[model samples]
Target: MMGRTRMIGGLTAIMMILAMCAGCGIGGDGAHDAVQKLMDAVVAGDVSGVKNLYTLSVEPKMPTILTGAKLKQPIQNVTVGESEKVSDSERTVPVSYSLNGKKTAGSFKVKQDADKNWVIQNPPVFGQVSFDPDLTIGGKPSTKDNKFALPIGVYEVNMVSDVLEGSWTVPVKASSGFDYQGITANKNRKKIKLTDKIKTYNGSMSSLIDSFNLLPMCRKLKELYLNGDDFAFISGKSISSACKYQTTDIQIKVTDYTPDGDRDGYYPIKFDATVKMIAPVFTDSGENDDVWTCQSVQGGRQCAKFVEQSFELKDWDGLVSQSNGNVYYRLADPDQNVGELADVIYAGHGVD
Candidate 1:
């Protein structure tokens, strides 16, 4: 019985020693290994591997923003120093590495969770700014800071909140054309304001009538009067200055609006209008012997005859309305989906 007791005591002592060694391997050495693995994952641009070493609570939420620009730099060397225990469950590991031909220093923390598994409490430190087409703006390479104020023009902006993982594109255009009205964006995202240029009828009776040129027509009549063979020469029986053609009661209506893709702020519209004008004509009296002449009486003078004519003008393309009130035509930008406004303010907006 005494011999059996001694053997049991010896076995218990050996088991305790083995347990101490196992604890040290998992708690101290394991933490140091976790820190090294984190740095290796960053250098390799392995976001999944990096997350695997993080605490379960933080792993899913970890952002790959640091990998945005750093992944392009190759990791030349990495040296990890001894870990210092903060408590029974946590440790800090010191690190130094060469990246992209430059030396850098940083630190991280590792901890043993309730299950006694080693995980990175803090990941390797790195800062990055990732952009589309490899961080360039206005055909120039971008600086470390991500913000940019580009000149007003058309641009295809590449966007990536975390460059290492994936990216999307943003098409931005700002100019005097009728298409792009405004734009909104942040560090890695952007939005373009869409609008449509609509054609409207804003002309008045007076404005439409003023567009007619009657001077040329009047000159043609003067030529007819000078031909004495056609007209009789009589005292006070000639074309008088008082004889004039006049337009009255002009009615206009706009039925529909259509967009033309080729022009800016100019579109086609359907229009209908009634035009009434006085026609000054020399009466052909059929008295072959008597030449054409004006008639005059004491109280009133009636020279040439006066005739009233009414006509309708309708067209699909000939008529147009102004989108910008300052002009006489309508215009639109095909690239932008914007609603119609009286005056399209297109020149000053930009993306930040």
Candidate 2:
């Protein structure tokens, strides 16, 4: 009776081991099938499924990485190659895939998580891409005129599709230096158009100061339409409505300029500004008055203590115009003082 019981106990233990192996997706044949599932998810652009194949740490970046990959190439087919176990909890997988009619081979390391499910242990793959005419982002130029590696996965590239003038398999990150990363223009590379509306951008201190008309060097503001239009230059009076601010006795002096050490094309500008202004307007003075009132009058002191801002301007001479030896520029956004002063002036608070 004792011998027979031992034999049965050994058989039960073997069965339990097999079940654990199957559950963790580590069985002899299961690893191949798991890798095949991941390849299918990628080819099908199954974002959810592909995400499930990787651990949680890599989940957040997967979307951007996938978007860049989709723009770089199209995966037509994927074949599972050699796969071997490195340990009880880890395995290596080799795969060959067809992209844009080209064959490429890649390797992956997959590991079993605490949940006993297999997950991809390698960072997603990305493809290299560049612009044809070359462009700059946030005043920082792309590598080697216009080349950089795209992030991995599925995504769209339409911000400047019209401007690029060619259809590509993958989307490209919009040139930097704008308020938004994906903000783009459909105009020619050299003849890009500035929006009629004043807006903030990222770039160099010189570009910001010039663009905002912070100093007197900018005079007789003009718009240079690079589209070969005969107008060439438009006066400040003509585009006054499009400008951010009009100043009277306004002075902007740069106190300091600091460049970012780690990243290119970024500079922080510190400035001290004084704007002459009439006192704020007030509708009522006391208790029942709805508007907040400090004092209502004309001709008062408005001094900015210390203000710091960052800028990203790539095209200075090209974006602005220099004629009669005076440089002219339009404001990208409303100056804080100018905007406040405008309100005061609008409310009948003018210099006495």
Q: Which model scores highest in TM-score? A: 2
Stretches off by above 4 angstroms in model 1 are: 1-14, 21-28, 55-70, 130-352
| Cα distance off (Å), candidate 1, residue 293 | 35
16-97 per-residue lDDT for model 2 (tens digits):
9987565344355455666778778766655466656755354223222223233234365667765677887887788876
State in Å the error of residue 126, model 1: 3.6
Candidate 1 per-residue C-alpha lDDT over 158-214 given as tens digits, one digit per residue, 9 for 90 to 100:
221111111333332212212222222223321211112222334455644544322
Q: What TM-score would every model get versus the actual structure?
A: 0.34, 0.36
